[model samples]
Target: MNSVYVDLAIGLVIAFLLFSLLVSGINEGLVRILSIRSKFLWAYLRDMLDGAEGKRSWIPGTIREVFARLPFGNKDARPKFDPLPPPVRSTATTWSGRLYERLREIDHNTSGRTSIAFVPPGRFAVAMMEMTATEGGVPAMLEQLRQDGSPLYGPLKGIWDSAKDDAEAFRKGVEAWFEGEMQRLTVLYRKYVRWVIAALGLVLTLFFSMDSLEYGKAILTDNAVRAQVAATADGGAAALERRLRDKCPEHPSDPYACVTEILASPAFVQIVGNAPVSVRIPDTGDPQWLWNGGDWLNRLVSPAHWPGFLVTFFALMFGAPFWWDILRRLTGIKLRQPDPTP
Candidate 1:
């Protein structure tokens, strides 16, 4: 096998192995870093990044429930829910959170510090999964509170209790509802983060694909580009005029004879209508053909040749990633991930 091919195979194998191990480490870290109880970090992050904002909604509702249970908390504050519009709600879904989680895992391994980097991402995934699974778990917990009449029931009962003062309970309920919502928000944030990461990966893949094509085009040009230099000597122009007039004495309709006469004319240049003619062959003294006679030049002069710069510029810019990736691998330079935080 060629040496370059051998090197490429070896390099690819190594990169694959490294990436695999790296991803595995990240998975483990996510489970370690994010906690089930304190997962509000993820929720808050998601709410901030994703377009899930609204006036009043389940967020405050959940918060109110939580506060109503507090020992010193007011029994009367009730929470209200206001749903956000579709666009803002959709925007709140962040792929950046997932990206951050993945990057955190990678950094933990690569940073070479305590090597505890594997812990965070592993925990994050677990926390995210739990959040989704438990969005309505609070209601179950409240049901349990109703049956047992436990201290935990105070806040839950107070926020929604028929006996509590309407205004005070509503206010407290809203506070507790918001607090609980903050938890669910973390889950949403994690999911959004993953989404963002997937999106970025797709975009990068597309750019690389285009880059590969352009790089290939450049390589083709290197071997196949034909120089369009003129073939005839400077003085040969005069001789051709003499030939044209003689052969076409009565302007023969025969194409071959007309061509022969044109070749012999001294003022051949003038008879050809002053269009620029390129010489056909280099270093040959006896024969030369006009470059303008070919179909290629005819096409160039056509009306369709309008978008010169746009076509040329696009071709030049395309296929850059293939070259870039090749260069980075050959030089042992690492590709940098985008920002770690959303």
Candidate 2:
């Protein structure tokens, strides 16, 4: 009885792991296509350097400006704005404005890119030093910072002052500051990614109709199906793990493509085929299949499938690495258990 329960659990984990891998691959593809990392980095930098007030003030004005210039729209259909001007503008003569202008110029010079997906600390420190430097170097930059009158001015001045005329020291200080901020930025980015993973997991669960309850029952009641799924998982799990680690490194320029390729591999196909789940989509061979919307909808929204759907959704979000570890531990336990005498 215990052996049967263990086998059922193993089968379910393997099935969930396969679906998790698919979700992860799809999410990576979306991330690359949308340039999500670059956009997040750009937004963070904009907010950090310009302050929240500056961002809030410019967004409405920018939207209006964009809509106002639309050639096809009604000439009088422009979005209404407050009669009062924004207290802070991107082009105003404030510290943020000046910094924004310099950064824009730098960005334009670098092949007209508006955002960079990655920035090394050394390069960032160098850019900051160059932005502050004048004909008189550190002393002039210090004086300029003192007169800037922005909230960041004090922190900027202190960083420079602490350097005590050593250019190398100043650069190191800037790098440290950037690294500290990056730690917080990383946490924020992960929170955003968690939501993305959850959403992708939900979509996959609905599309595949991977009801965990149904799958569990199938594995428990059908000895052949359970054995097939378990054997495939035992053989393929290590391969999948290696593919994720090795393939991505070999093709660093397009890790998402590598993930997609892995999903489409023969080994993965075998694993998925052995699983007992069924796709809810109607077969296109039927003449009226396209018109059978009610049948399709009924299968998708059936109350009996909801529990399994939720289970699959949460499992996928837990991700492939997690299930891979669980599989390893379970397999080890099974191997260590003493064989029963015939």
Candidate 3:
């Protein structure tokens, strides 16, 4: 019985610790991966726009000239090229329109996809990574186009680089704002984690202390627990002997079996919660155990469960943030701020 209570208490503490660790690791790891990818994309785009690479590619060039003349850009920069053969002309127009639609869809989706981990490394890192990669990719793409001998290559490269640059700059500015918020977020995360762990610790400690105190009090009071032992020495022992003699007149071993069976009766189950009050056995100075409907009534009404589940519920809720942070640190993941605009 003593060992059972000790095991229960130890199990509760261990379960709480494991829950915290699991949540923390998953959240932090996600943040770090997103931040890294965002920075890489940003730097690639910037490098493309600045023409850091030697030569401009043709496909991106033509697309740039077309969009540049849209209502948003310089209207005067519109192109005046000769008409193409029917098949070539139709293919070029269809491809160009499809490309335009795709770009627009991507721009719309970018707003919803932003994350927190990008803030810690700062906007400059994002910008440099994006610009360098895109600028470097242009020359390589141009060589592919030239070898493939694709017509309308000039327009494609023009539009691609211009549109790509604008997107890179906008993303950089957004990340810059998030960078300013990173410090504040870090402080808030720490405070929340500490508060939860402390609260859970306090509750768990109280539960164990209260359970121990109650058991100790029961033992010292000579209440229900004390009466059961006294019963055996009084009528309980004699009744066992009489029953064995009646059942097996010639069997000497039957008396010991009878005694063992009496000791292991259902009447000896522990008094859990509000059970029947122990009855005072007449002339024995010991209590006789009987069901009084108290245990059933208490089981239905009482909120307390064995060791008190109040401590368990609080331990779970409060421990979430602390566990989240520990996992983030171990995984080198950044905590992302919730998007302010959203």
Question: Judged by lDDT, which candidate is best?
Answer: 2
Please list the C-alpha lDDT of all candidates, in the order they appear: 0.36, 0.58, 0.39
Structure candidate 2, residue pairs in collision: 212-308
Candidate 2 per-residue lDDT, tens place, 43-154, comes to 4564555444433422223334322322122221111222232232233344433443334423422322344455567667775666565225766755665565434555
lDDT of 1 by residue, 78-184 (tens): 11112221221122123323323333333323322222212243444343323223334444544644564433345545554652535444444545554565555
lDDT of 3 by residue, 1-342 (tens): 565444444433444555445444543463354342333232222232222233642112343432232213221111122232222112222222222222231232233332222224344334323432443554454454456443423533453455575645544543554454455545644543444344444444333222322333343333332344455446664654654455335444566554444343322122232344434343346666666565545543454543434444455555655545544554467968899895
Instruction: Point out the higher-scoring one by lDDT: 1 or 3.
Output: 3
- Sort all candidates by TM-score, best to worst: 2, 3, 1
Q: Can you tell me which runs of candidate 2 are displaced by over 4 Å?
A: 53-115, 134-136, 142-152, 224-296, 333-342
- For model 1 the TM-score comes to 0.19
Best by TM-score: 2
What is the alpha-carbon lDDT of model 2 when measured against the actual structure? Answer: 0.58
Backbone atom clashes (below 3 Å) for every candidate: 99, 1, 35
